[model samples]
Target: MDIKKEWIHFIENSTEQEQEALQVFLNSLKMKRERKSLTHIASLLQLKTNLVEDKMLEMEMPNSPLLDNSIGIVHGGLTATLLDTAMGTMASLVPGNKRGAVTVELKVDFLTPGTGEKFICRAEVVHNGRQLVRMEGKVRNEKGVLIASATGTFFKLAD
Candidate 1:
């Protein structure tokens, strides 16, 4: 059968809790599809770029099963992605510059399990050079517990 019919059949057969999970998953997928301005991965994670200014970027992500691991905590890889994205955003957004940057290296230290109602990532450029930018970021839970810290190096893209 086609995917939509199969999805409807599965929804009809699922238990209440399962249905809720599926609904949340579907809503996330719908949000990704509907929000066209963000990059695909950013859309998938439902990240909101809350702040961007000189040398810094801040983004927020809501707690969702889509970001969770088998143990019901946020996945480490997702945390890394969040930190990298934030750092990369800060690295690339230099005043009077139109170039973008791509990650050359990312080193993440997962300090604590990502457990919270929401998470925020704050990234700041440590060094911004003509060719390379160095950035550091921290992921914090809703209560301000440090979940992870990351350092990243990015190279500017040619215009």
Candidate 2:
């Protein structure tokens, strides 16, 4: 397909808001390409895994306009995504784990509007069963205000 042609036509007819949306789309693609070796979702969210300690993980992401919704706040879905990532990482990175895990179920509770320069997400492994893992996660603003809390269940991969 002629992506250049479609882009030219879009550029000619797009409004200011549409252009902004296009910018965000392009940035997401760029991030996905750059972080392909790691994780596309992490790149899209610009998440930094700042800590990986025993049965826990800590990460951070900026509250960018690209991640904002119509109200100029971080979208709830993105918040959930970060929590999921944190919990999943905790499950996968546990010591002597021969295989990773996939989330089987997730539950999120949004506590407040997500507004801040950045977000801090932390996850702890609540239980590590032979075939399933349970995790708890919390997302907070830079000011340490809780934004959302979550629980996740992951199914461990068979070795």
| Candidate closest to the true structure, highest TM-score | 1
Model 1 TM-score is: 0.89
Give the range of the ten consecutive residues with the poorest summed lDDT in model 1: 35-44
How far does residue 90 in candidate 2 sit from its true spot (Å)? 1.0
CA lDDT of every candidate: 0.85, 0.86
Per-candidate TM-scores read 0.89, 0.82
lDDT of 2 by residue, 21-99 (tens): 6776677678788764277668767788856678888989887667888988889999999999989988887654568
Candidate 1: lDDT over CA atoms? 0.85
TM-score of 2: 0.82
Best by lDDT: 2
